[model samples]
Target: MLKTLASYIQEYKVPSFKAMFYVTLEVIMEVLIPYLMSDLVDKGIANGNMNIILKTGLFMILASIFSLIAGALGGKYASIASCGFAKNLRKAEYKQIQDFSFSDIDLFSTGSLITRLTTDVTNIQNTYMAIIRACVRSPLMLIFALFMTFKINSKLAFVFVFAILFLSIVLYFVSTRVHPKFKKMFSKIDCMNSSVQENITGIRVVKSFVREDHEREKFSHTSDEVFSLQRKAEKLLILNSPAMQFSVYVSILLISWFGAHLIVSDSMTTGELLSMFTYTINILMSLMMLSMNIVMLTMSISSAQRIAQVINHKSTLTSPVNGATKIENGTIDFENVYFNYGHADEGYVLENFSVHIDSGSTLGVLGATGSSKSSFVQLIPRLYDVLSGSVKVAGKDVREYDLKTLRDNVAMVLQKNVLFSGTIKENMRWGNENATDEEIMEACRLAQADEFIQKMPDKYDTYIEQGGSNVSGGQRQRLCIARALLKKPKILILDDSTSAVDTKTDALIRNAFMEKIPDTTRIIISQRISSIQDADKILVIDDGKVLALGNHEELLKTCTQYKETYEAQQKGGDFDEQ
Candidate 1:
């Protein structure tokens, strides 16, 4: 964990070094002023010399003014150093997440990843600032003040050293107990974040289904665990404070007792004793700062570990060494393919799933949930690698082509159609960055989205709510289709994407595809037989195995499962053509 944190710090080492330099200057100013003041009191005032008093007093005031200026400048530098590092870490984490494959995302929950990015990064930033301002200065203050103590009176300085050892032992025990609690506390934080995020994102469903009380109870339980752990951790660590204060008080009492004897014996001057006492207190105060800094550092280290776990995760899917730039057409072939997520020893989603999809061909897939309809098409772009088979696109293994090039040629409209909060045109442009107004209109027309979009006040430029909640389900699906059309991909996979559209609009969309993408490979997955009826080929899947493979009309004649599904829908009369 420390090594990972050290790497992040190394990125901003130059700025950190500069910030430390400023901190050192600031500490020097702080230490020098106290010594000057001590001199003015012990030497000048006690000597009854006006000139010495005036000169030393003026010097002390000047030192204080300089220290204030250094502090302000040093604080600014610390902010820049700490904030810049945090920003870089956040960006790095985001970029790493983008590079991670579906498996990586599956390993970590969305809520957990969010906490790691935001809360963990903030903890690190606060720790960095504390180190720059307090961590560096406190140690310097303790050392310099100890040196000054020895200079004033060695006997009193020995008293200060005893106090240091006592405090160190006390803090060691407190920190040991606190460290594990802090680790637990941070884990609780992750849990709390997860609970809150899930509840908030799904609150509408919770309310509609009357699960608000249940969700609230769940969130409260997680939150209570966090609060309990924090209290325990804080209560354990705070024992150090009263313990140190009591030890310091006893040491001061002893110092005064010893100083009185020395003064009476004429071994230590009263003025020298006073200065020594001042330096001893300064040392204790510095130790207090050091203790607090350690607490902050401990928290930061724990948080950094959580973040590094995410950043260091390597995705199994990687780009090719000598990769292709673009796929020619979209010819895809899965040769005796077998694939299982995670360990191959586990059950397979696709076992010996051999199929070939040629350029300009339309293949329809029918399956129950978890029968690998979506997973089958997902392989064309290598979303997950085949465990024991070769997946070739355009007559070459997918692994041989650049991942970006492979994914760019194959566009997928998933079952869950999502739209970001932006103008419709802006979301469509995500498919083709260079798409112009004319291309945008053409794609919208092809998806049958132009009619509803034009009904809006701003037409194609109308702003959409998050997830396109302002539009009906069918409209959202059409817009997603339009977005994919804008890309003009060589292959398009509609994974139950048209489930929400009416038959009329669905037919219009099918007609548009026939006219516009005459040469693009198309894979359609649907529960409805009518959706797959017009396809050149249809694959019936049941229990993770292909039950039949033929055109829709042929499947109805030969495959009992296909015939049953077709007859079931026909009995409902909803399969009637619009």
Candidate 2:
């Protein structure tokens, strides 16, 4: 984990090294002051020499000024280095996420990824800043102060050794006990974030169902779990302060008592004894800083591991060494494909699925809820690889083609319509970055979206709220369809995308596709029989197998399932007339 995180410190190496250098200089200057004061008290003041006292006091003041300047510079550089490191880390993680396939994403939750990117990264950032500043300063201060104490009088310095050993043992014990709790606390944070995100995203549902109290109770439970784990971790860390204080006070008392006896025997002067007291405080304070840093480092170790897990995750799907770059046409063929979301033992979502779609043809897919209709189309773009057999697009195996080249040729409007926070024009531009105003309007017209967009105050330039919350469901679906049309892909798959719009609008959109973009293969997945009844071919899928494959009239005469579905819908609403 340390090595992985260290790689992200790409450009910040110089500033971090400079920060350490300045902190070292500051510690040296601080350590010299006490020694100089001891000399002023012993040789200058004791002999009634005002000149010696004045000169030594001036040196001490200069030392203090330099120490202050060094400390300020160290702080500035440390902040720069740590913050830059964090920025690089976040960028790397986000870029990695972008490269992940759908199957790779399924391994982690949205909430867990958010926590790792945010809270965990913040924790590592704080720990890194402390390492560059206090971690460097404290150890140097402890060593220099101990050297000065030994130089003044070795007997009292031994007292510090014992105190240091005791404090070290206490820090080790506290840190070991607290580390596990911190790890558990971060997992709980992931759960809490998941709960909060679900509630906020589904707030409309909660209000309509009058389940606000239930959501609150669920959120409270997750929140309390986090709070409880944090308390347990903090309870262990709180022991550090009292243990440090006890060691510090005991060392101070031992020094004062031993120095008094030494002064009486002429082994240590009054000035030397005073310096010993100052050095004692300096050494103990450094140990206190070290303890605090250790506590922080312990917490960050868990965070670092979590962050490294994300950065180091390799995508399961990779492009072939010399992948194909171009597609011949929109033709798609699934040859005896078998697929499952997880391992093969979990059973296949699409088993032995075989289909051949010719270029520019319209194929309508009808299925029950769990019939793997979406799963079948997903294999065309290689969103998830087939477990066995070949899924070919334009006469080349999808895995053999460059991933970007394949996906760009196949446009998909999934069952759930999503729009980013931007203007309607901006959302449409996602389909084709270079699409002009005229081209955008043409696609929207074909999708039956132009009328509604013209009704809005700002028309195409009107801003869409995040997730297109400002638009009605039908409007959202139409905008998504228009966006996909903007791509002008070789193959377009609409996975129940027109469900929100009225049947008349759906028929218009289908008709527009036939007239405007006749050379593009269109696959429509819908539950309504009316949506697919006019297609060149219709498929009836159930339990991951094709039960019927033919045009609407052929299936109605030969297939009981198709006949029954068509009759039921026709009687329910007289939909057959349309």
Candidate 3:
């Protein structure tokens, strides 16, 4: 955890060290003020000289002013350190999300990731501020006050030292026990975040099923568990205050007793005794500050460990060392490809599969839900690597070229189409950043999206709510297709993109693909037999294996599985149920 904090600080190492230096100087100055006040009481007041009293009083005031100035400077430095750390943390976490592969994303719950990025980061930031201020200043104050006490009377200083040792043992024990509990608290928080997020995202399903009470009860259970863990941790931490006060009270009593002995012996003057008592108060107060810092240290350590777990994760997928293929007029080829979602030694998803696709031709893939149709196309962009064999684009192995070069030439429209909050044109621009107004319109027309878009309140300028919630399912599908069309890549993939649209609109969109998007290779994955009936070539897949390969008529003649699927579709596809 300490190593992680250091790495986080290293993000702004130069500025952070500068801040530490300034804070140290401020703490030193702050400790000196009480000593100056002591001098004013012992030397100035005891002398019975008005000039000495006034001069020392003025000097004490100067010390206080200097202390305040140092404190302000320290605060300025601390702000720079903490905010800079937070900015670096956000950048690193965002990069991690982008680098994660499909499998990597599947390993963690989405709401847990959100909590780590948001709430976890906040906890670290708060703890960092405490470290820069109390963590540094409190120890310095306690040490300096001890030194001043010993300078006046070593015997009384021993009383102070005894109290500190006892407090240290107590703090060490409590902090050790609470460390594991703080970590557990954060885990519980992540679980609670997941419960709340799932409820909100699936609120519609809950309402439709009339399960509001069920959901509320489920969420309440998670919340209560988190609350219970938090209470347990806080119960231990609450011991800090009384323990600290008890130590301070004992030290004060010891000091008072020693001062009384000195005054009776005339070995210490009344004014000097008064000065010792004030310094003792300062020492005890610093110890109280130290106790609070110890608790914060525990919290920060737990948070740092969680953040480090994320930062240190190695992404399974990475760009090729040599770089990606430079694609032009996309041509895709699969050569005896073998793949598995598991490790290399595990069972394969696609075994010894081989196919070739030419430029300007469309290859339609028909499959059941587990048939690896989507997985096969995902290989073209190298979303995941094949365990054995190669995927080539434009006559070169994809691994030989950089990832960006390969993706730049390909556009994939996933089955689950989603839109972010933005105008219709803004979402389209995600496909082509420099796309012209004419190009967007042409792409929309090709997608059969222009008809309904024009019907919208602002046409191309229409606002799309988050997840395109304001639009119907079919309309969202069309806009997603339009967005991909705007890219104008060499290869276009529609992974059942037309599932929500009516058969007529789906046909129009397919016709536009044939008429307007010439010279671009297309791979369409769908379960609907009619959707792929007219393709130049078609592959029927079942249980991750290709059962047949041919045009619609050829498949009906040669393949029983293909024939049965086609007959079932003619009756009414499962998509109708959806």
Candidate whose lDDT is highest: 2
* C-alpha RMSD (angstroms) for model 2: 1.4
Give the per-residue Cα lDDT of candidate 2 at 437.
Answer: 98
TM-score of each: 0.96, 0.98, 0.94
Which RMSD values do the candidates have, in order? 1.8, 1.4, 2.5
Query: For model 1, how big is the CA root-mean-square deviation?
Result: 1.8
Off by over 4 Å in 2: 343-345, 574-578
How does model 3 score by TM-score? 0.94
For candidate 2, give the lDDT: 0.91
Question: Which structure is stronger by lDDT: 1 or 3?
Answer: 1
* Candidate 3 residue spans exceeding 4 A from truth: 1-22, 343-346, 572-578
Q: Using TM-score, give the best candidate's number.
A: 2
Model 1 C-alpha lDDT per residue in residues 1-578, reported as the tens digit of each score: 66765676655677777777877877777677667766677678878888988998888788778778877877887888899878878887898899888888778877778888998899999998888778888898888888887877776788878888888887777777777887887777777888887787677788899998898898889888889988988897787789779867987898899989988998877766776666767788888888888877776777888888887888889997879886887888888888777765668888888777878989999988888788788788889887888999889999999999888888999878799999998999989989999899999999999988888999988999988888988889989999998877899999999988887778889888988799999988999888889998998887666778899789989999889889998888564354
Clashing pairs in 3: 323-401, 323-402, 324-401, 324-402, 325-401
TM-score for candidate 1: 0.96
Clashes of 3: 5
Q: How accurate locally is residue 206 in candidate 2, as Cα lDDT from 0 to 100?
A: 91
